[model samples]
Target: MARPKDDDPDMFRIIVATDIHLGYMEKDPARGNDSLVSFEEILEIASKNNADFVLLGGDLFHENKPSRRTLHGCMALLRKYCMGDKPIQYEFLSDQSVNFDHCQFPTLNYDDPNLNISMPVLSIHGNHDDPTGQGNLCSLDILHTAGLVNYFGKTSNLEKIQLSPLLFQKGTTKVCLYGLGSVRDERLHRMFVHKNVTMLRPKENQEDWFNMFVVHQNRSKHSATNYIPEQFLDDFLDLIIWGHEHECRIDPEWNGIQNFYVSQPGSSVATSLSEGETVKKHIGLLQIKGKDFMMKKIPLETVRPFYMEDIVLGETSLNPDDHNVLKKVEAFCTEKVETLLDKAAMEHTGNRKQPTKALIRLRIDYTGFEPFSIHRFGQKFVDRVANPKDLVLFHRRKAGVKKEESGADNELLAKIRPQSLDSARVEDMVRDYFGQVEETSKLQLLTEKGMGDAVKEYVDKEEREAISELVKYQLQKTQDHLKVRNASEDRIDKEVTHYREERKKRKEEDEEVAEALKRAHSMRSQSEDHPCDDDRMSLDSDEESRTTRGRGRGRGSRSRGAKETTRGRGSRGGRGSRGGRGQMKEPVIATNGNRSILDAFASSSSSASQRSARGGNKRKTYSGMDMSDDDDVVTIDDEDPFDISSSSRKQKSQRKTTSRRGVAFDSDSDDDIIPLPKRRR
Candidate 1:
């Protein structure tokens, strides 16, 4: 690389900054104005330096979709300085025309003096402002359309990433500015290895141009995790602007290249309270000549002062109730706050005279006290100090505290003996020591001095066994109740069956009545249709035979309506005289328990036939029903046959009780209640 000739144009001075994080303060209302304030301060500094243009590395906004208030404030601030004043003009150095494939266009005419954009802001979207959805639009697109900023480093096609350079001639310096937006680590690695992906560079003899590469990538010297190695960019780029790191850094003549420089402006405001965030932040100003560049570190005044203090309590088993220890911690916190206030007062000047509100992070190293309870000491300090907006208190066990060797630990360590100590042997010893220490700690927790004693001291072995037996007894009782309930359900099923049988019997009786009526109707129809004397004679003969049989059975008083025919005959030889015989009787139907009416009738008919064969005039009984020669003498016992309650009681009494464990309690004795041991308060 050669220096620019003295006859060439003036030097190019561009203000370079990154990670404004515009919407970062939306969460904490008290500190919600911090990010925007810091950003405004940066813009003011850029304006005061007479910068040609502003280059934002990445993450101008903290969120993909900033809040309405945040966007408004940002637009107003940018437009106030960059709009309607001295529109910048750049002479084209390369043959390539300006490409707006995935970018936006200005709303107003660029050449119009009324629509001049003076100090134009150029930036690329970081991870936070990257397209979140399929739409492929971001918050930066809005500002671009409004003619407030120029957003490069985007591709119209998402499947491929291509770096597009903004080629311009500022004075005699041919500048080729190429930008690559933030990509996820995995995807970034893929892009780097891709055959089609390549950086935008000057063609052929145009290599004399200043080739500056802007990227938002994690670059670290020691760890390769998610970082792009600097060696990879050695040949392609002259100057590299790095972002996404919070600490400010400048490496002039990077990689031992005399003219190559890698500069990082870092975050203008702290987004998180990490160790790196407490460092002094700065914005960078790059003055580029032909192959060489000069970077100046400008400290940011708008960043809130942050102080992190770590106090070692020195001893383990700290008591939270110790007034002396509490006083010591309180004094330490007070001294740290006073020191910060004094520093702020010395630095305070001009229009920034408001009392500095500091973020004091206190880390305490103490053991045996719960982390939550240690906040009491921090709270005392907070109450004593004024203008303390936020106080973060953290407690941890001292990192290298020496542990007292117990007898058990000593015995365990004594068993391990080796000739000499190598790395492997030392590692083994360390592992064994830690293991023994952990086991000892666990064993201590089990003794009477530990919390387990609170429960073990009161309940002895006998009481525990008694409790176990009681649980088993109650479980057995529950099972018995379930069995009794099942039995009751079975009984209900039986009753339902009995009722269903009765319903069937009533239905059969109805059918019989219907059949009798239907037969009578047919008989009347036949008599009316057949007037022939021969048909009538035949029907009369049948009727006469049926009547004679009924009379022989001594059923003279029975209605001529023709009762249901009985299957069995009586034992009497002939019809008795009217004076001696009782009124004619019609056999009544009787049902046995659970037996169908037809089955009962069949049984009764068979029994009567056997009695008639003996030829004796005797009364018969069937299923609690009395049948005699007298038709008026009918006896039926109405009492139910099944005693349901008595059976239930018998089943319950027969259920075996579970055998008692431990002491037996006789409920039948005078004392039914067993006394229990009083609980210790």
Candidate 2:
């Protein structure tokens, strides 16, 4: 590719890369410094080229909490190559407060007088290094705090995203760089579909500035909503830097529909031995002059070479029943390994500084043949390969499988392989597991998205009570809804009872289904005679009913509730201690003041009450007392009842109170009060 000329005074030269994955395999003796070396090379390139700044897509570090060695190495590299006395040419035009809201300095590193930064490294957090814990801090935040990197695109709110661009100007050219760090793919997809994400455009020169967006999301369709569609972005964007995918496709591709150019500067270091990671790694030099930009791919010479191949012993002239079968199979595998080593050596010919040991993966199909010990076979390449233990894997092709089903299986595996390395989040795993179930079989009270979010919170934040809190919040909301409809006391009790029974039944059924699935999977693995293919074939069969249950429980619960209500109506006269079967009760909803879980629901309910007041709804009597519509209603009483003074009771009696369903009550009267039903226990 031809490089753009550097003669234009208004041109902006920026170095762009992503998924450096620093500290990957940091403990491994052979590959400990691999990520650090490549990262240093990238910084050296930026310094040599005199780039305006270094733009990182995401995942600068492989681990969310990087080790001390990784942090020290990263700081040393940035200080060595990025700090200098060189004058900065480009000028920041955006509001620093909005762009760097998460940072204390709230300005460019160079702009801070305490820090002498020459090369500004601007980045967003990827799934691997996203925020966690109570402080909502990521590894990048530490770097940002140290004034070594400028971290933008840290989304504080997921309900509605308002993307504010970091605008910069060089001479007469202007560039508006919008960024959205990384959000859970499914949640982000839903936001896009609901039109909740808003891009804040430049207010002044709307057409003059070149609009560029940096996003770290799944560019490919992993599932229905696992990836963001290109069409979701606004058409006004000139170019987009896509990240989070590991494949190296640094060249720009035009999206004809959106009329924008997309350049995916994939990961600079290989974090896995998958085929996608085998692509030659490269970073890009992005040059922008006004609305036109060019990408120059610079190959990294320090990345370790990886080679993979698959062989079938059944296809070759090898007999399983022969006395020398094991020897022949070993010989064939040895030849393949030697050939791959030679290929890696040829590829690494010019780069003498690169690691000598290459990553090799040989998948052997041993159908109709006995498999040899992989541990013993790998011992031969312990000295020649970086990953000897996983160099060779054995598998068997199941017989009588349809082509369509086989293709589907392969596609599913393909989607999982790249992410399974390091980018797979807890939410992604939960989403994938639930993806196999039929939509109708999913939980009716709680959404699949909500459950996935809860599980993600529990895993990522180590919050032991997150799942329980979600269950309680959902149940509370359901009960509140029942109260809003002004159901009779007996009806509310019946509905609540039915809900509890259904939830318990579903829980039991799900446990049984999960156990059965586990047993079936185990049996299939034992019968397959190939343990190496377990992970790949785990979700192959029973794809639809994998995590699903029959709807019989819901139907049965409804029928039983109907019968109980009918029987209660017949025995109404026998139970005189209880109120009449159809008697209405004042809605007394309990509120936990200490918990913030229901704060959102409280706010929504308050707004609904305001709307109801605006609609001029009439106030109804609760205990034969007429109250004005302007009376203050407290449906959820959080005050201390025992500590109330006589003066406070007088004040309460003066002000008329109403229920959520518009039933007004007198605080001083108790003649018409009906006692609530006591627990059976």
Candidate 3:
């Protein structure tokens, strides 16, 4: 899979270009296709030079999602030069260790031997194309899916931390090409943080391969920090091809990093007629050997000639209505247009042919000529240009005229006026101001509260009052500080009294609640020890009859039931508490129809007592015994009929109601009861 090194030829022949910016001229219908045309020329240059492959920096499209027309046009040009005579017959060196399933638009023809792809275009998405949300759904994805190009550097797969490179072999040099698509400045900063980014590292054959890093990012000298520093990149890259910056430059070897060549191939077309872009546009032709490389700047001839004519008027007081003055402006434009056309003709005399149309920008600067009249004059001359339809006009005021209109010169003089502040006067004023500050800092008058009479002898009554006010404020602040310090003992005593009274009331209430619960639990334990199904029913009937008569159980009945439960426990003693309790009879189950009515009265009665004693109706589910692991014993299925809240309430009410009726109310229902809430560990 390697190109022969028998003759020791360059290890790789690469064509690096970027910022094609297709559709840049969408607004300029006449010249809008200029960017696309220049891009076609760049491809031709790559083909003519027999470049091994092409590396596009970014901004291949001017928009994140280009128009259908732009996309089709760009694809047609790429297919012309890139579609090979036969299908591609290459295998990735790291295919076994990588996966492309995460690619949203993976190429079906990536390994299709019947589909030929030559000088495969490898590109990263630029700012214009690198949009949010469409990590793998951008315009480039469309081309990649069609097998027109190879797009790398997207980390869509969660399984991978770093982007795997596209590998190729040419003679003794194994090329490992990696790319990082353009990212916003702030996001990129986070990527550059220590341990934040997972950069591509060399594998087992590091010494045998030469690595090239391709990136689309701003790399201007002034804001170089916005880009990944060259020194930082040199740790892994043998060469760096940068894009996004529309200026062509080359550093044979970045001074800080040895053996690392950095190249910027600028843009193929003039996206703007800016001063920097006005220079000859170029692409880089890189010839790389094992560790040595050479970069040649090849000029692109598809650019439309741009003519910027600056016509400065002399101090002859030219009038806009003057035919002579109009003629003078017209002549300047005609001369400049002709000069550019001739120059374009000469440069395209060889293989490359420049566009015939020219962009003419006229800047008229004069004191007397009105802008409207001068514009009309410029248009007349522009109409006569070789190709008026292709001519673009621009107008501007000259520097001198602009200055006169704005009065900037006068403003400048005012800003730099040395006569505004004399050194002696400034010194005296500064001294006087500081003298007043010093006098105020050490003023004895400020300490005197009633200094109105004494200070009036030397100053005005108003000044004396001002000093007295200052003294009064200081005195008040001091008094407030003392008051806060002296109030600590009184505040502590009040807090202690409030908490002591609250604790005493809480203790009394807790004891009453504990006694009531103890009686309820003892009745249930006594009932469990004596299994009497007939007795349980008798108790229920008596309680129901008593409640129906509108007479709750008499206090004598509660006392008699409590005595009987105690007597039962004493008669059985330890034998009844243990063995007898274990063999207790199961309680009579109440149907939903009957349980709801019984539970209602229980809740009302319990809540009444709690409200009267604690001033709050706080109901609690009380399990007589500790059942921390009770959940492990009771199985609750989806179809379980028992709801813990209602069941616990029904059982508690049944026992209390029966006991109030001067009868034993014992049941086995408490054994299947829900466990209490566990205390914090």
**Which candidate ranks first by TM-score, i.e. highest?**
2
lDDT of prediction 1: 0.56
For all predictions, the C-alpha RMSD in Å is 32.3, 20.2, 26.1
Clashing pairs in 1: none
TM-score of structure candidate 1: 0.53
Candidate 2 residue pairs in clash (backbone atoms < 3 Å): none
**Which digits, one per residue and each the tens of the lDDT, describe model 2 over residues 1-681?**
234469678899999999999999999999999999999989989988889999999999987778899999999998888788887888998899989988777888899888778889999999878886545688888888888999999987767899999999998889899988888776788889989999999778799999989999988887897799999999999989999989988899989999998998898888877778878899999998877789988999988888889898889988889999999999999999999999888878476568989999888999989988888988999999999888888889988856556877888877773443445667667767777888666465654555666776556545445566566666675678677767787788666656645655554323322233334344444445544332322222112111111212222111333321111211121222222222222322223322232331233223344335435432221211112321222122223436658447534433321111122233323344444443353
Quote the RMSD, in angstroms, for model 2: 20.2
Q: Tens digit of lDDT per residue, candidate 3, span 345-364?
A: 66552544566655555444
For candidate 2, the TM-score is 0.67
Q: Write the per-residue lDDT of candidate 1 for residues 1-681, one digit (tens) a residue.
A: 333333234566688998888988676744677788888888888888777788998899887778899999999899887765564645545433344456545322243355676677888878667653323568888887777787877654434665767776776567788887776543465456554456666665566787888888777532343467666563657888988777667434465643466787778777765556667778877777766667777888767766666666555344567756665556655676667656755665333722256555656665544343445544644533322343545567646978899999999999853221111322234334445675445321111111121122113111122223333433343345456656465565454444435434443322222233334344445555657444443343222222223224443323243222222122122244221111113333333333443233233442454345435433233332454342222221221327787545434422411111123232322244343333354
Pick by lDDT: 1 or 3, better one: 1
Candidate 2 has its poorest 10 consecutive residues by lDDT at: 541-550
Local distance difference test scores for all models: 0.56, 0.72, 0.54
Tell me how far the alpha carbon of residue 342 in candidate 1 is from the true structure, in angstroms, after superposition: 2.4
